[model samples]
Target: MVKYLIRRILVSIPTLIAISIVIFTILALAPGDPMGEFALNSGITAEVRENIRRSLGLDQPTHIRYIKWVTAFISGDMGYSFTSRLEVSSLIFQRLPVTLWIVGFAYLLGALLAVPLGVISALKRNSAFDMVLTTLVFFGFSLPTFFTSLLLIIIFSVQLKWLPFIYNDTLQLTDFNSFIELIKQSIMPIFVLGLWQTAVLMRFVRSEILENIHKDYVRTAYAKGLPNYIVIIRHVLRNALIPVVTLLALDIPSIFTGALVTEKVFRIPGIGALLIDSINSRDTPVVMSITFIYGILIVIFNLIADILYGLLDPRVSSTK
Candidate 1:
């Protein structure tokens, strides 16, 4: 297992490098000059703006600028955002935890709720329970995250007054003070994210369970006079969960994608919101830094998924 994990980690280095290069190149080629925007905003004279550009190394050729950016990145200096005038690294670090909390809670809650619901749906296939769950899953899957968030806010916050309408700050880490606050404010976003995750998980889990019930091992277990619940939980659910586990590993990292909508809607100070703001403000350094970070995260998650696959099914290691 250690050897396989090490091999996978080693292989991810080149993949991450490729991803970084592609991302950097695309951003570099994108239209809009960071210096031009700054100059325009400051109402600086052309001569002063030209001098500012020169001092900032913006006058350099694209290749030279990219080289400088990459070198700074390697040295743990992501440069400064043109708009915010703050270090890109600091900004990202500041906002990262909010997104993490939102995504993490959503993933955990969705998995916990979906798995049992899916199992029950499969167990009661063709019954009212199954029909209700199926309809719910369809509704959850069909609703977009923003719309779901709005509906939840209206019903739960505005009409019912059960929870707050939006998440403006990250939860505090001490004594769960911030956690409670986050849970209250983040309910709508979490619910939206959770609903989609639950819908997808339910469908997959039901499918996997249905497929595994026909397996020879499951038949053997049933033939041995095991209780139906025990046969299902121990003999069937264990083997059936491999695919769900794989999806879970992949889903963890993907939670950040498109989370800007939720963050903006909720007024949360998350990395997703920051990224969107940086792009709109033409902060090249921030955009590049966030892209690089996101790329690294994706590569790391992919490797993690591969390792989890091996762990969940030892046969995968031998095959690899």
Candidate 2:
């Protein structure tokens, strides 16, 4: 297992390099210039602009700039953001925890709800409860995230007054004093993400459970006088969870990028919102840094999934 993990980490180096190359190439070719924002702002002359350009190494050839950026990135210096005039790494570090809180809570809550709901629906197949859940799942899957967030805000925040309408605090990374308030602010966004993820996860769980329940192993368990609950829990749910694990492993990283629309709608500060702002401002350092971080996360999460797959199912060995 250790050897496999090491090998996976090794493989990720080239994979990330390739991803960075592609991201850098695409962004470099994009229509906007990072210096353009400075040009538009008042009291900035051509000399000032040229000085700014020189400081950013933007006056150099594109290839030279990319090479310098790549080298700096490899050394863990992600460069300075042109718009914010802050270190890219520092900015990401400040916002990462907020995103983790939302993503982590949503993932756990979504999976917990999805598993039980799926099991109940599958066990009581064709019942009213099952029908209702299925219908709701369809709607949940169909609705866009931004629209869903809006509806949730309107119903829960505006009409019901259960939670705040917006989360606009200056979140500090080092402070734990505002933890309670942070959690309260996160509830709506977490629910919005959770509800959507639950719909998809439930469908996967329901399908896998229904298929496994009919297998010979399940029948043999029943024939051996095992209780229905035991058969379902030990035999059914165990095997049914493997695919859900894969889906979860892939889906979690998406929250980092996928929450852009939801964050915008809720006025929540997160990595997704940062990504959009970086893109709009054409802040190459911020954009490249975030992309690199994302690529690293994907590689790490996928490796974790593979390792978990081997652990969960002994039939899938590390050697294989």
Candidate 3:
């Protein structure tokens, strides 16, 4: 296992480098000046603009700029955002917690609800409860996240006045009251994101469980006088979880991607919103850094999934 892990890490280094190069090249070729915001300022002369460009090293060749950016990034400096004039790394770190809180909690809540609902649906098969759940799952799955977010805001925030329309980033989670406030603000966004994930996962869980339940091993377990619960939970669920684990592991990257839409709708100040703002402002450094970080996360999570596969099913060998 250790050897396999080492090999994967070593392989990922070059893979990450290639990914960074492609991302950098694409961003560099994109049509926008990082200093375009200053172009309309009549107070800033052409010479002053040139000087600013020189100071930022933007006057250098594209390859040279790329090399400098890569070197700075390797040394723990993520460069500065042109618009905000803040260190890119610092900006990301500040907003990362909010994104994590929403995405992480939503995914966990979705999984908790999805697994049980899926199990019950499969156990009951074509019952009325199963039909109702299926209808709701399909409805949630088919709707766009932004639409759901807006609908939720309208219903809960505008009409019902039960929850806040927008998330309050200022709400600190130190004490109980602050924590409760955080939950209140988070409820809408979390529900929107969690509902979609639950719908998707519940279908998978139901299908996998149903398939496993019909397998010979489950039948043999039942034939050996094992209780139905024991047969399903021990013999069936353990095996059924293998594919679900893979799905969940890969979905980690989607936490950021999905948050992009959700954050925009809810007005949450998170990495997703920052990415959108940076892109619109043509802040290349911030965009590149965020994109690279996302790529790294995806790669890391894929490795984790492979490791988990070995753990979940001993028949699956990591060494291979």
Candidate 4:
């Protein structure tokens, strides 16, 4: 296990390097100037903007800039944002907690909602209850996140006035009331995210469970006088869940990806929202930093999924 893990980590280093290089090169070649905003200023002359751009090292050859960026990255100094002139890491860290809280909890709620509902729907396949769940799941999956977010805002925020239409980033959690206020603002975004996750995952869960339930081992467990529920839960579900675990591992990292639109809709001040803003402003340093970080995260999660496969199925580790 240790050897396998070390091998995976060693392999990931070069993989991450390749990802960073590709991402940096693409962004470097993209047709957008970090000084675009300055160009819009009627007061700043073209020559003044050129000097500003040169001062920021944007005038350097792409290879040189890439080399400097990579070196700074290795030294734990993610270069400053082209717009804010603030350290990229600081900006990410400031928004990281918010993204983790909202995105993480949303995924958790989704899994909690999906697993049981999927099992039940499969158990009662073709029933009215299953039909209703399927219908709802269809809408959940088919609807774009922004549409659902707006619908929620209208129903809860505008009509009922039960929740805030926009998230309050400035509010500090110094008291219980503040915490309650936070939950109130968070409910809609979480629901929007959770609903979509549940829709996608529930189908996979139901399909996996259905495939496993009638297998030979489950029948043998039943023949051995095991309770039906015990046979399904212990023998069937155990095998059914292995692939689901991989799906879950991959999906966990993707919660951030899905949260990009949700965060913007809710004005949550999350890392996703920051990344979008940075991209719109063509803050190449910040864009490069965030996108590279996302690449790293995907690699890490893939590694984690591989490790979990070995843990859940000992045969995998034995083979290694």
Candidate 1, residues 218-317, lDDT tens digits: the string is 8898889999999989878887888787787667765554377878877778888898898887787888888787777777777777777786678878
Q: After superposition, how far is residue 11 of candidate 2 from its true place, in Å?
A: 3.7
Tens-place lDDT digits, model 3, residues 263-313: 999999988998998999999889999999889888898788877877778
Would you list the clashing residue pairs of candidate 4? Answer: none
lDDT tens digits, residues 1-320, model 4?
A: 88888888999999998998899899988997778788789999999988888887888998898889889898999978878889999998889888988999989999999988999999999999999999999999999999999999999999999999898999999999999999999999999999999998898888989998888888899889999889878877777778888778777775554378999999999888998999899888888888887787788888998888787777876777
Better of 3 and 4 by lDDT: 3
User: Candidate 1: which stretches are off by over 4 Å?
Assistant: 41-43, 157-163, 170-183, 255-258
lDDT of 4: 0.88
RMSD values for the candidates in order, in angstroms, are 2.9, 2.9, 2.0, 2.1
Which of the numbered candidates is closest to the native, going by highest TM-score?
A: 3
Q: Which candidate model has the greater lDDT, 2 or 4? A: 4
User: Highest lDDT, which number?
Assistant: 3
Once model 3 is optimally superposed onto the true structure by TM-score, how far is the C-alpha of residue 66 displaced, in angstroms? Answer: 2.4
| Runs with alpha carbons beyond 4 Å of true place in candidate 2 | 1-7, 171-184, 255-258
Model 2: residue 315 alpha-carbon error in angstroms? 2.9
After superposition, the stretches of candidate 4 with alpha carbons farther than 4 Å from their true spots are 41-51, 255-258, 318-320
What TM-score, over all chains together, does every model reach? 0.88, 0.88, 0.93, 0.92
The lowest-lDDT stretch of 10 consecutive residues in candidate 2 is 168-177
61-169 in candidate 2: lDDT tens per residue? 8789888888988799999888889998888877777777776678778888999999999999999999999999989888998888889888888899887768765
Better of 2 and 4 by TM-score: 4
